[model samples]
Target: MEQKREISDEQRFCEMRATVEDCNRFACALFQQLSAQNSGNLFFSPASISTALAMTLAGARGETAQEMHNALQLTQEGAQLHAAFQRLLSETRTGGVELDVANQLWGKTGYHFLAPFLETIRDCYDGGLQLVDFQEEPAAAADQINEWVSRATHGKITELVSPMSFHELTRLILVNAIYFKGAWEDEFEPERTRDQTFYLAGDQQTSVPMMHQTGSFGYFENETLQVLELPYRKRNYVPQFVENEDGSVGLMHTEVPGGGGDFSMCILLPRERDGLNDLEKEIDSATLQTWLTMRHQEVIVSLPRFQLELEYELNTPLESLGMERAFQPSSADFYGMTDNPEGLYIDAVLHKTFVDINERGTEAAAVTGVVWAAGCAQEPEPPKVFCADHPFLFLIRDRQTGWIYFMGRFNQPEHQAD
Candidate 1:
């Protein structure tokens, strides 16, 4: 029986791992769709979006649930899926960084929802249901929900929900907010930052402030792309190796604690300055996972200091990913959320994100609302060069779980002339 219990625990972990894999695919699909629409800068938080949708999924049933499951490529079903979410959310702990993930459900004050739905959210997602007057005071309800999101994100995302999006039929709104701030393990000296020429698409160029650093980082490269992992500061130290007198390297297990982290910002720079489009075109889950593998080695990194804030309405993009019925009120089926025969359909999905990457590190916040609707690299013999002087792809993710929190592309650089 003990062996069986261990096996059961392992299987549950596998299920959770599968969920992360599915989220990787979902991120790729979303980036492909959104990138195609916008030729400039693009950024979004897949974790935030997935978490909010997962909350809604707790109350979804029938085809609605299956569509979401398929679109997300979720492996676990029913209770297993929620349990996976619970563990995943709990496992995102790191000591030296400020990482916060918050979820909440705002339901109509008078609307009657199934107890199981609310309980599942509270238990698995740590999201408690908050009653609001969406029926009579839609604007107030939006403000209340927005305030929660803003607080969760440390004001990085203040107005995620617009009052105009609320309607009489909008009975529930699910929200997920994530905020992360981590300094680079080896921070760039502000004095080293200088104006550099960043090549943009269409043979354009812009002067931007680029930070420079020379340190051992996770690095990888191929004939087509160069990948660099800039880790954030975390609690405790990571294993490092030093060359011995006998020309051998040995692991230094004991070091100053709190010198490394489990979170990193991975930048994928194309071999050719203008190869971003082709690189992006070839992105898929398998190829992406391949690119993320890296070895720790000495690297010369040059990264631009940029800030971006963007909003997206994900209805069409999600529909394109085979989640069609959820947006269609007539065809949508969310019977598990409430006893009402006229079930809830995903009315709108609004997402807002803010990221500031400078010499210090990265401070990012993303808030995703389902509106209920219900709705790095390796090492080497010699130091490698990873200069983001042109269009490139970037991902902020957990080094341990391979879960992408935020992903984006930097195409046109904002002028930061010193």
Candidate 2:
């Protein structure tokens, strides 16, 4: 008899990491498509935006691969050929820009193949991304996608799509879908949340709800930055913090020191809202990676908490940013896979996200064994005042794979849901 092979814990962990990585890559491609279409309206860095796209792709249906190829006029073999074509496209570009090739392929094919994925996402986002597929009439697909954008984002985002035309021989559809909903771990009491003065830049201030709290929580501080962890009403929802050297703050996914298990929420509440612009200009992939590897010393953090909800539609923005080749049936040459290749084309890509942050903590809570950091400092530091009043970018990412699950900016807070 053959000996039974046992799966080790590390092997299981690696498998999970792969699943998350695949999802992240797919979603990042979709995000690239969105960014390509909408040029200047977004706030996150390109890499952060890519991570958000990865998060969305995690929710896509497994059948999407087959459906997408069929719509594009490619067989499994043909799709593989198209992928090879993309590889060649990458080789043609110089420097890190080569990665843009992946984004281009996603932008082109993601939109066309996204119908079914959108349908699944609609149910996930509470009736967002509704597109009526009239088999007999076959109305303009762009129009349908636009309608979904209008309804899902509560009208904050309009015209996510435009009229499109393709050669009858090459038009193919690819679908990308995403679904995310997170609540605070500690619930903010509506009564406790009171309108307080929020300090904006340049001696500016706005009255906003400032949720107050004091508890034994995860905290860290250093000469360059201060850190804090605020759990939502749900244990699963924990937002981490990273205060910068200049007193400005930003949000980051909290990971275990030494690269252990999953990630936690970390939001860097910058001292100045406008400081984000300068901060963004200085940020690059390497900067972020360096920050994560830093050794933190004795730290304590206290933060005033609040709640927020946000949603976005990112298709139109992606196409306008130099990725039009993938969407064009004539220009798209995905014929390497099958002999019966009439040519493969792409249709559309769609994404939706929901998050609620409050004083009570996150809505989804998960209890797990905590890994203690050895020789770390104790004692909470005086809480730095950080409030998100103006426009700011946010992202959700997987700790292990550095995959971004969601990315968007909160431009108008009033439009957010409860």
The candidate that achieves the highest TM-score relative to the unseen native structure: 1
| Reference-based TM-score of each model | 0.91, 0.48
Off by over 4 Å in 1: 1-7, 237-259, 373-380, 416-418
Model 1: lDDT of residue 162: 66
lDDT of 1 at 135: 64
RMSD of each: 7.3, 16.2
lDDT of 2 at 110: 19
Pick out the ten consecutive residues of candidate 1 with the lowest summed lDDT. 1-10
lDDT of 1 by residue, 1-418 (tens): 0011223777877877888998888899889999988888999999998888877777777887899888776776777777778889998766567899998888887778998888888888888889988767778887898789889999988897767877767888888899999888888999999888888877888888989989988888899999999898865656888899999999986535365688899999999988998999999989988999887888888999999999999998888888888888888888888887667898888899999999989999999888754320423477777889999999999888889999999987765434
Question: How well is each residue in 333-400 modelled by candidate 2, as lDDT tens digits?
Answer: 33321122344433434333334445533321110000101011545555443345543444544343
Poorly placed runs, candidate 2 (over 4 Å) = 1-135, 139-173, 199-205, 218-227, 232-263, 289-324, 336-341, 359-393, 398-402, 415-418
Highest-lDDT candidate: 1
Candidate 2 CA-lDDT value: 0.36
